[model samples]
Target: MREINNNEYHQWIKETKEIIDKFPERKKSFKTSSKIPVERLYLPSEITNSYLEKLNFPGEYPFTRGIQPTMYRGRLWSMRQYAGFSSAEESNKRYKYLLEQGQTGLSIAFDLPTQIGYDSDDPRAKGEVGKVGVAIDSLKDMEILFDAIPLDKVSTSMTINAPAAILLAMYIVVAEKQGVSADKLSGTIQNDILKEYIARGTYIFPPKPSMRLITDIFKYCSKNMPKWNTISISGYHIREAGSTAVQEIAFTIGNAIAYVESALETGLEIDEFAPRLAFFFNSHNNFFEEIAKFRAARRIWAKVMKERFNAKKKKSLQLRFHTQTAGSTLTAQQPDNNIVRVTLQALAAILGGTQSLHTNSRDEALALPTEESARIALRTQQIIAYESGVTDTVDPLGGSYYIEELTDRIEKEVEKYLQKIDELGGAVKAIEEGYIQREIHKAAYDYQQDIERKQQWIIGLNAFAIENEKMPEIHRVDPIVAQEQEQKLLELKATRDNYAVTSTLKALKEAAKTDKNLMPYIIDAVKVYATLGEITNVLRDVFGEYQPS
Candidate 1:
C-alpha cells in the first residue's frame, strides 16, 4: 500500500464529510476507557512510514500481528473452561460434561487448603475443604480427579502457586499409573511465585528459596517433561487486582526478566527453558485497548528476548498466552448482565489471538456456576469461533490506524515502566521494596473512585441497577464434602506404607538443605502416597515461611 499525498488526504476528508452530510445529525463523540479519543475515520496519512515494519507479517519478527502465520484459520483457540469444586468425583463429572460439550482443554482450580499446602483433615483446613475448588490431599484424590480421562489426549492447566511442585508431582505419578510417560504429558502449572508476593498472597516460602524451587522445576522439566510448561508467568491476577493494561504487561515482563536471569545464573541455556515458558493474562472490557494490549505485549516480549536476553531460538521469542475474562468485571446485581460482559471480553481475546481462553459464568459473582451456567459459558466461545467471522483472518484489526497507534503508545509506556523497574534493581528488589504493590494499589484506588463518582458506569452495578432483581440458581458445595474428604485422607494414611513415606520425606528435607534439585525427591515422596501437607511441612521447616513485612 502507498501513502496518500497531502492534497489527496485533505480531499478525501472533504469528500467523506460531504457524503456523511446526507444522514441525520447525532452526537458522535467517544473515547476509550484509557482516555484515548476515537477518531471518526482513519486515513493512511495518519500512519507512520515505518508502520509496515511494526505491523509485519504474522509469524515474523516482533509478531505484532500474531505468533502464527495462519492464526485461527489453521486451528481454533482451545476452549478451556476453568472449573473445579467439591470432591474429586464431582469435579471429574464436570470435566467429562465439559469435554462432551466441545471444550478442548481442562483447567483445574484448587481449594484453599490444597493451594496453601494443607490436607483436608488438618485443623487449620476446617470448614474450607472443597468449598472453592477440588480438594486433592494425596495421590488417591488425584487418581480419582483424572479417573477416566486420558492424560496424553488432553492438555491440563493447574492454578497452584506455593505448592505447585507437589501438585505437579502428583500429576506426573497419575500419568505414570495410566502408562503415560512424563514426556508424553502436556500441561501448565501456575508456578509463578513473584505475582503471589506482589498481588495474590498465596506465597509460602521466602524469596530466595521460592526462586530455587521454581528454577528447579525449570531444570527438571527441561530434561524430563519436555512438553510441559514449567511456569506460567501471570499478568491475569495483576489486572484483577486493579492494574491498567500497560502496568499488567510491564510488571509481567519485569518478572519474566528475573526468571530468565535466575535460570542463567544456574548455568541453564536461554533457549533450553525459554521455549517452554508461557504466560497468562486477563481480557477486560475496553475492546480496542485490550486487542492493542495483546499486540503490544507480543512485540515487547519479542524484542526483550532477542535484544536483552540474546535469545537465538524463534520459539523463545514467541509470546504464547492463555487469556481469561476479568472476574472482577462480573456484576452480581443483575446476574444476566454478566453474560454480555463475558461475550464482549471473549471477543476481545479472540481478536487478540490468544492460544486458549476461559469465559467466566454469569452467576460466578455469587457462587460456583451451576451446570447450566457453565455450559452457557462454553457455548460463548463456540459461538465466536464458528458463528462469528472474526477468526477467519489473522489479526482482523491489525492495520487499523487507531489500533496501530494504540499498540505503539502502549509499547512505549510499558518500556518506560520496564526502565523504572531496572533502575530499582529489577523486579525482585522492587517487589521486596513494595514498589509494585504500591503502584497497583494506586491504580485500584483510582478506579474505585471513578465508580463512586460516576465517572465510569458498570451498567447494572452503578447506572442501571433495579430493585428486587431475582437471583439465578447457583452451584453449592455439599456441607458433607469436608467430612468425606477428611475420612478419605484418614483411610489413606492408615493403609499406606508409613515407613516409605517417612524415608522419602527425610530424603526430601536433606535435598532441600543442599543445592540439589528438589523435584525428584518430591516426586519420590508423592509416589509413596505422602499427603500434600506433609511434604510441604518438610520444606517449611527448611525454607521457612514468607512473612510479608
Candidate 2:
C-alpha cells in the first residue's frame, strides 16, 4: 500500500464527511473503553510517523506488528483454558475433560486457601476450601490434580501469586514423580505480587520480602527450568479491579520494570531473565480499542527493554502475554448474553496477537462454570482459530488507519502514566504510597458514574434490561468439598514422616533469613509431602506478615 499524500488525505476526509452529513449519526458520544473519543473518520494525515519508525514488520524491533513472524501460520496460539475447582480429583476430571475437548494446554486456578498459603484443615481455611478453585493442600493433592495428565506433554499455567514459588516447587516435584525432568517442564507462574499490592488483596508478606522471594525464583529458574516462564506480570487483575485499558498497560509495564530492576540488582543480567518474563492482560468488550491496546503494549515494552535497559536479545524485547476475557464484564442478568460478550473479547485478544487466551464462560457470572459451559468456552477459541479467517494473517488489522492511530494514541498515554509512576519512585514506591491504587479507584469510580448517568450502556444492565428474567441454572460446588479436603489433609499429616518435615522447615527458615534461593528447600519439603501452609508458615515466621496501614 502506498502512503496518501497531504492533499489526498485532506480531500478524502472532506469528501467522506460530505456524504456522512446527509445521514444523522447514531449518538453524539463515541468513545473506547479507555474513554478516548473515536473520530467519525480516520485519515492517513492523522498518522505523522513513518511506518518504519512506528509500524515495523512482525518479529522486528519495536514489534507493533507482532512478536512471531509466521504467527498462526507457523503455529496457532495455545488454546489454554483456565479451569480448576473443588477437590483436586474433581478438578482433575475437568482437566481431562478439557484436554479431550481439544484444549491445547492446561491452566490451574487454586482456591483462596491454596492461593494464600493455608492448609485445608487450618482454622483460617474453614468453609473456603475448594470454594473458588481446586484445593491442593500438599503434594498428595497436586498428584491427584494431574493424575492422568502427562506433565511432559502438557504445558500448565498456575494462577498463583505470593506463594507462587511454593506451588511451582510442588509442580516440579509432581513432574519428577511423572519421570519428567525439571528442564523439560514448561508452565507459567503468576508471581506478580506487585499487582497483589496495587489492586488484588491476596498479598501475605510485605512488598520487600515478596520481592526477595520473586527474585529468588528468577535466579533459580534461569539455571534450572529453561522452558518455564518465571513470572506472568499481570494487568488482568488490575483491570478487573476497575482500571482503564491505559492504566492496565501502564501499571503492568511499571510492575515489569520493577521486577527487571530487582533481578538486575540481584546480579542477574537483563537478557538472561528478560526473555522468560511474560505478561497477562484482560480482553474487554471494546473491540478495536482492545486490539490497539495489545499492539501498543508490544511496541512500548519492546522499546522499554531495548532502549531503557539496553537489552540486545530480540526475544528479551518481545512482550509475550496471555489474555483472559474480562470477568468483570460478565453479568448475572441474562447471563447467556455473556457468550457474545466473551466472543468479542476473545476475538480482540486474538487480533491483538496474544500468545494464549482464556475465554470466560457464560455461566461464570452466576457461579463457577459448569462442564458444559466450560466446553463451550473452549470451543469459542477453537472456532476462532480454525473456522475464522482472521488467523490466516498475522496482525490482521495492523494496516487499518484507525487502528494505527489508536495504537499510537494508547502508546503515548501509557508512556505518560509510566512517566508519572517513575516520578513517584517507580512501581513499588508508587504502590506503597497508594498512588497506583488511588488512580485505579478514581477511574473505577468514574466508570461507575458513567453507567449510573446512562452515559455508557451495558446490555441487560443499564439498557434493554428485563424484569422477572428466569435465571440460568448455575453450577454449584458440592458442600462436602471443604470437609472432604480437610479430612484428606488430616490423613496426610498422620501418615507422612513428621521429623523430615520439621527439619526441612527449619532449613527453609534458615535460608529465608539469608540470600539463599529457597526453591531447593521448598522442593525437598514438597517431596516429603509437606503441606503448602507449613512451608508458607516458615516464611511468615522469618519475614513476618505485611500489615498495610
Best by TM-score: 2
Count clashing residue pairs in model 1: 0
lDDT of each: 0.93, 0.92
Write candidate 2's Cα lDDT for 1-549 as tens digits: 999888987898788878878887677575445577787778766776685578878998888989999888998888887888889999999999899999988999999998899998899988888888999899999999999799999999999998999999999998998999999999899999999998888999999999999999998999999999999999999999999999999999999999999999989999999999999999988899999999999999999998899999999999999999999999999898999999999999999999999999999988999888998999999999889999898888988989999998999999999999999899999998999999999999999998998887899998999998999888888989989987897899899999999999988999988989888999999999889999999999999998887
Cα TM-score of candidate 1 = 0.96
Q: Against the hidden reference, what TM-scores do the models get?
A: 0.96, 0.97
| Clashes found in each candidate (C-alpha, N, C closer than 3 A) | 0, 0
Worst 10 residues of 2 by lDDT: 25-34
Model 1 regions lying over 4 Å from their true place: 1-31, 35-42
Candidate 1: deviation at residue 14, Å?
11
What is residue 383's positional error in candidate 1, in angstroms?
0.7
**Which regions of candidate 2 are displaced past 4 Å?**
1-34
Local error of candidate 1 at 63, Å? Answer: 0.6
